[model samples]
Target: ADDDECNNVTNICGEWANCSNTNGSYYCTCEPGFASTGQPRFQTNDGTRCADIDECAVVRQLCGPFSDCHNTNGAFYCTCQRDYSPSAGPRRFQPGSGTHCRGNHRDMANLTESRSMLAEIAAKTSGGELTSMEVISYVEALSLSSSWHFEGRGDMEATPSVINTTLTNLVEAVNNLVEKEELVAWTRMAEDLRENTVTKLLHSVEQGALALGRASSTPLQLDIRASEMELKLMTFDLAQDQLSVSMGGDHIQITPKASNGSVCVVFVRYDSLGDILKPSSDPGSADYSRFGGTGEITVNSQVPIDVDADVTNCAFWEYDLGTLQGHWATHGCERVLVNSSATTCSCDHLTHFAILMSSGRSNLVAHSNILTRITHEIQSTRTTIHKNLCCSLFMAEFIFLLFCSVIAGLLHYFFLAAFAWMCIEGIHLYLIVVGVIYNKGFLHRNFYIFGYGSPAVVVAISATLGSKYYGTDKVCWLSTENNFIWSFIGPACLIILVNLLAFGVIIYKVFRHTAVKKPEISHYENIRSCARGAMALLFVLGATWTFAVLHILHETTLTAYLFTIANTFQGMFIFIFLCVLSRKVQEEYYRLFKNVPCCFECLR
Candidate 1:
């Protein structure tokens, strides 16, 4: 007789499969809600395997709208999405179970729904069934609902009650979990998950406290106690003078600056959270690990102080919502006093406050002294450097003043000389373009005498008339007072008018030459060159000074800007017109840079 292989100890069915016995053989089939990898029926040795079928993926809206379908092994379940709940039946249901999710819009408007939700969360948390993801999801849902209600109603008066209920219940649940040691696993979880959970809890509490403060105009104090934790909230009108508050055993004194809003302070003391938030042994871990292992005191004064500890820090939870992370920071807080039983803190702002203490007094004090010495040395060096810099600046100003008078006289002579040379240029261009008397040697001699000799005479007369007007306290230029400025502007305007007249004549001659047919190439080129040079000088030398004159006369924003730009780019215009646009100058530049490896390649 054939043996019943399905019933034998060495059954041939794979995991999640059922074995069936036939007349002379046995085959394997996947169990209900699972599918076989190969054929529906096959022997175990044929590489056939059974896998749980994903009903949710295969069927659309398997859990209906507004719900999330959670696939399980050989089964599936459904739960409502955030801000929704089942209209009927249990929270977790199956597809087509006559249960539909309904929006909690109306429910979230009042405190009743929030109370029920908080109660549920509290029960789950206390029962050790709430996960980190669930906690975060629930808090996010509550926050979203609160924000939505406020946006819809344009008020948050009703939100404080909901927030208050959430806080009270959450504290109770966390306290119960602490008593049962269920939260011990928090420290063992992944670092990111642990931090996210803590951040959410702290943020939720802070939001509740802020809402309460805003809703009430008068001073308010709420002290909530749990078996293993305590929460203290205080709201008071901000004052210019220092104000102090004491809670548990900690004390905080803050002098708030003038503000239009009230100040809300929250202090949470979690005996178990401290144990779970143990400092990492590795120094290179997260910033929270750097906190000492002594103990934590919450809000003004509540936790038992560790007097023997060497270091005490008054810190606040700095949460960055963008990154969804938080860490204790002592930026605006100072440790005022620390004794055997109590610690005092002073802060410049309001927030969730705590006291962090560490033992090992000898090592800490020694290290602190070394740090203090290093800091003092750094500060002293900085002070010396600053003093030296100030002295150098003072000496520089003094030296500048001492030579300013001499420089001003030179500038006056040079500026007049510049206009005198511009006048020579206009005359030269006029002679070239108009085919008038062009005496190279005679004109060159006269150019030098007029440019240099005339400006020297002007400077001499001006200095003799008013030597004190050569320099002013603000600048080394000729002073505007006592009509001294005209000494320079008058000559500048004369040169500018001469250049303009020369430019107009050159343009007329060029246009007349262009009208001639079959004109001499040499004459044509000369006229062209003269026109270009004349136009260039007209703007570079004459137009800029014209704008300067306008700026002095009208002093409008447009004239000031135009004058500034024209002067600033004067050198650039000269280079472009006299060198970059000139064929002879281009050849010279190429020859100069041809020997350079980079320039040679670029030129080639």
Candidate 2:
């Protein structure tokens, strides 16, 4: 019998090679995906070796398009590229797995199919031909389609036709059901379900209008449940046309402009929709404490309405495709008419238009008073604490009279350095908030150079040129002599001014961005956020130096007090705004406190 060399402990084969035993002889051959260095077959002393063959390097288009080929030690595998996925099986596979890279189309396909089905349903339900069963089916289909998450712009673009068809069909269906005395069936559904249906309808309508993109020649009109909608397409010439749409005693008129482009006006009047979509009362909810009353078209009686109240706002549904959230916004639309019976809106562009009636002047006045009182109390407390702290620092400075000149020089350098870093912080903020491009490595290198080196150079030049003016009699600080104090004051003031300008731009950009991206946010909330941002910038950028400069230019007790308070409490302000208010820091604090024994005991 032949010796089984293939199964022996000390096989006569190199790694990745197969050993074969025959009539009193055995041969070694490299396995698939590996190559023999010396020969195809060898004996124990033939000096043959096996090595992995990089099949990916040798083969082109190994994984096909929209895929990447990765080489392994002995073989190669394929994976779909970003934004693409395999049609079947695992994400990574060999060539023979029958899997192919494909663009994400599942959401798009569902939306497209749903839209087609809706169009068919609308055609069948038109002209008072709707039944209760058919109405239920339509609602179920719309709800199911709306529940599918839209992935990107492609999905949004394919959705407008579905929404248009839905509105037209829904209005007709409801009207027919009412005429047949079958409306009570849907009305008897759970309030939450009814609200969800209406909300989804509103969301679909808003998204459709946003994604409409172009005007159609055909007109659309709908009225149901005390709500009405009229959509018309017209060639709007900036120089020659004024578009007007009126329905259900409400009117919209606009002077067409070049910027308005080809316009399509869609008007919708909702009755019970408002009752369902009321603003949330939960304090932690996004819609909590909104400036307006319930999201309803009717007038609110809780707050007084003036003859020229500005309480009635011309608004449109602003929908964010990314978040799939819709909010009533008054940015582009304006109220042209307001009365007891009806309100008219005028807009530069076209969308789902409506009227938002708010609680008027009393609320504004009350909020303002409360904010002013709180601000005053905070200022008084901060001033008292800062005054005592400054006095203590002043006394300590007098005690350090041993090296007055050295102390003054160090103080000048340190203050300049602090301002330099503030300037850098402003630049960093601008890059993050406004600038399109940001290179971390580049910023890191430049920040160290300018933040530290610039202050060092300024101090070195000042000490060399005006060393005698380093100390004063009253304090171990730079003297007010020969305009030499400018070395520190000049740079400090400039940095403060630059930072202020940067902050102004940042606030403007933030407001504009919020308006565009978050149109659902109320004006009051926007203003409050901007105010908080400005306050944060004031402390972080050391803008209190402006008060100091004001006192220097023309001394006043108020300016002196203001400067003292701001400068002394700056660190606390930084800590409060940057750390205490930080969401991540708050979460960390919660996690830490939760693990503490005292906290556990307290909870127990």
lDDT of each: 0.61, 0.56
Runs in model 2 with CA error above 4 Å? 1-405, 597-604
Per-residue lDDT of model 2, residues 1-604, tens digit only:
7778778747569688889888887888888999888778876585778889988889888898778999987899999875468999988898888889975532323435444544554555455543333444555555444443232434444344644554455444333333323344445444554444444555544334323323233333333232333332122333435455444454445544555234444444443343334433211101100111011122211111222233455555565544535655667666555543245555554444545553321211111111101112122322332333233333333434344534787777767767877777777778768756856666667766886689889989999998988875445767655677789889999999999998888889998998889999999999999899889888877787899899776554588689877876776676577656856556666666877887865533
Can you give the TM-score per candidate against the true fold? 0.35, 0.34
lDDT of 1: 0.61
Candidate 2 TM-score, C-alpha based: 0.34
RMSD of 1: 24.3
Residue 198 lDDT (model 1): 68
Candidate 1 minimal-lDDT segment of 10 residues: 363-372
